[model samples]
Target: MKRTVITVDGNGMLSIPSNLQDLWMSEGELVDMLHVTAMKLHAVIRSIYKDGLLTVSEVQQKQETSNGIWQTLY
Candidate 1:
């Protein structure tokens, strides 16, 4: 997993680095390109919570069923 230190300002705003922003933009573009809907993503999150644990394989399976594009990100 990639980790980065993020600091929140006194106003409660997070200061995201440019690289992170670029990464997020690319992810967004990919999601759009793949036609992944918000509801599909939410369903994946709900399934994870219903399982009461975070498992990488389970998440990948759920994502595969929901969007079929998450594996590419990994």
Candidate 2:
């Protein structure tokens, strides 16, 4: 995993770090991808807040299940 610090401006805008911006541009043309990713991240944060922290194995299991479902649907 990689980590970087970002600041929210007074106007509530966030500037994407340069490294991540490059990856996003290479991946697809859809700007909606960022919104979808943010929503998924919010869901994970909410789950942690409600249920407490998850163990690594528990997180991996959930990820596998999510990927399976996504693959099946796609």
Candidate 3:
């Protein structure tokens, strides 16, 4: 796997590259994600606060993982 650095706009938004957008099934889908980082062969993630902003935070009880795997690669 390879990693690419993408720039976020002043509003912290990124423009998905056309080719990459097509590569991902979740491209246009609504997804709840905490954080994302791609380095070398890894794509790391974790639960995000309901609202993905710096100041606002989600409580601990609300951070537990739910049953089963919502996403996994074969």
Q: Judging by lDDT against the true structure, name the best candidate.
A: 1
- Rank by TM-score, highest first: 1, 2, 3
Candidate achieving higher TM-score, 1 or 2: 1
User: Which candidate would rank higher by lDDT, 2 or 3?
Assistant: 2
The best candidate by TM-score is: 1
Please give, for residues 1-74, the per-residue lDDT of candidate 1 as tens digits.
33233445666676666565322223333345446885675576568877887754433321232455553231
**Which ranges in model 1 have alpha carbons more than 4 Å from their true place?**
1-30, 55-74
Better of 1 and 3 by TM-score: 1
For residue 13, give model 2's deviation from the true position in Å.
Answer: 1.2
Error of 1 at 63 (Å): 23
Q: Order the candidates by lDDT, highest first — what do you get?
A: 1, 2, 3
Using lDDT as the yardstick, the better of models 1 and 2 is: 1
lDDT of 1: 0.47
For each candidate in turn, the TM-score is: 0.29, 0.25, 0.21
